[model samples]
Target: MNDSFKKIAKTIKKSNSIALFTHISPDMDALGSSMSLYYAIKSLGKKVSIFVKDNITETQATLVDTNVFEKDCNQSEYDLFISTDTPSQKRLGDYAKIFIAGQRKIVLDHHLNDDLKGDLNFVDTSYSSCSEISYQVIKELKVKITPQIASYVFMGLSSDTNAFTNSNTNASSFKTAYELTLADADITNINELLYKTHTTKEIDLKKFLYNNYHLENGICFCLVTCNDLKKLNATKADCDFFSSELINMQGANFAFSIIESTPSFYEISLRSKHGYNVRDVAEKFGGGGHICAAGAKLKYESIEKLKDTLVDTIKYSGE
Candidate 1:
């Protein structure tokens, strides 16, 4: 094992109680790595808890035990704190203070951002997902890949890679998937739940997105207002993956979806095709993610003003 991996493994082994965390708006990759490591450490007889500030969407919760996540962390201290799929402590939301309070902290991530807040950082941008990195860490810990752990890891890998269609996918990712399948992970079931299954409300929102999206200067953008969501009876979960879908539009180098989750509060999801880097766009708004896919949350006075600002930002950035 490499020095970084070895250091992380040694730290985990020495710790008696471990706390795990991810970013604010936790995605499948974040949840997958955190929960998979939770099982691994628990199997080793270590006390473990996952602190998640955000409520997991119903679709993502199906991949693993939702009970594993706690809204609040009660412990005054932990032996070790590990963050997965989170670039910085700021993204940890309310749990940032908890992570800082730990005796030792480690960050396992795949983002290109180097502003790591962990005492021990194991970050590899080449890795397809944080789940893949966690797989390596668990292997070094000598933890057996149980079916349950394998399933969670597989869920993370599939979702973050967009079913292995994103640019980040590589031979290593497929090899890891193969091993997880050998461990009896239910790949078929994961695929159906993540990709195939969607509620009626989700389908209608997608239709609305396609019909109403604005296209200009190689950018395709759409907005889902709070009123629109209320009329369709859709939650934020129904809007997931909409930005990724927009990136598939013909001749569009960049695509974005702005969701008004609450009044004047917007969640922006950005995607890029043809080697464009959406992470730069997101970073400009104080968000950071992968090169092709990134996001940010903002609050504006009005949706019209938000759209105008976003269009100008995207146009100028793309040029």
Candidate 2:
């Protein structure tokens, strides 16, 4: 086993109780990886629990059953805490305290920019998802990855890669999927849970963007005002994948979506064409992700000023 993988396996082997966690506002990738890791450890006859900063949207809740293990934030007595898909400690949200206070911890993540603060860290920026990392760790430990594990990890990779369309996917990802399929993973059922369950509200939100969003300088941008969100009856999760659609727009160099999370706060999402790096843009505004996909949050007094600032930044940077 590799040094990093050994470190994690050793930690798991020594611990009696394991508490698994993911980033705030858990997406499929984050949730899948955490849950899959939880199950893997539990199959080893260890006590395990999974916790999230907030409840996942109903759409995601239906897809993955978090009830498989006990769920809560009280980790004062837990033996090991595992943080998945979180690039930094700050992104842990309310659970930051538990992560800091926990005596033993491990972090499995795929973000390019990670300020990992863990006793054992397994980070691979090149990998498509943290679920992929979970797979590797389990394989190195010589544990059997069952069909249920495969389905969850596949959901993680498929969701993060937009079903393998993103640039992060590689030959290893395909081989991993194939190996998992051999283990009895039902690809059709996984896809049905992951992608085929969009709600009418989400569809209406997408239709609104299709009709009103605009593109400039080969960069497509859209704004979801608080009023628009209210009208559409959509939550932040509903619009998570909204910006990815723009990246594929013919001749577009970058795609962006800004959502008014509060009157004074805006969350921005950016996606890029082949050569561009969205992380640079996100870093400018104190956010970060991969080269092609990234995000940032801005607090402004006026929406028009925020819009102008974003447009000016993108236009002048020539990104």
- Candidate 2: tens digits of C-alpha lDDT, residues 164-220: 877887988888888888988768987876677667776787798899778887778
Report the number of the highest-lDDT candidate: 1
Question: Using Cα atoms with residue i matched to residue i, what is each candidate's TM-score against the true structure?
Answer: 0.95, 0.93
Q: Would you list the clashing residue pairs of candidate 2?
A: none
Cα lDDT computed for each candidate against the true fold = 0.85, 0.80
Off by over 4 Å in 2: 1-3, 68-71, 196-198
lDDT of 1 by residue, 1-319 (tens): 1247777898999998898988887889988899899999999998899988676677887776887777878656577889899887678888888787777889899887546578888888899999999998998899899998998899999998999998889999999999999999889999999889986766787788888888888888888899988987777656867888888989889998888999989888999995788888888877778889988888888877877887788778857
Q: How close is candidate 1 to the true structure, as a TM-score?
A: 0.95
Candidate 2, poorest ten consecutive residues by summed lDDT:
66-75
Worst 10 residues of 1 by lDDT: 1-10
Candidate 1 has an lDDT of 0.85
Models, CA RMSD each: 1.8, 2.1
Strongest candidate by TM-score = 1
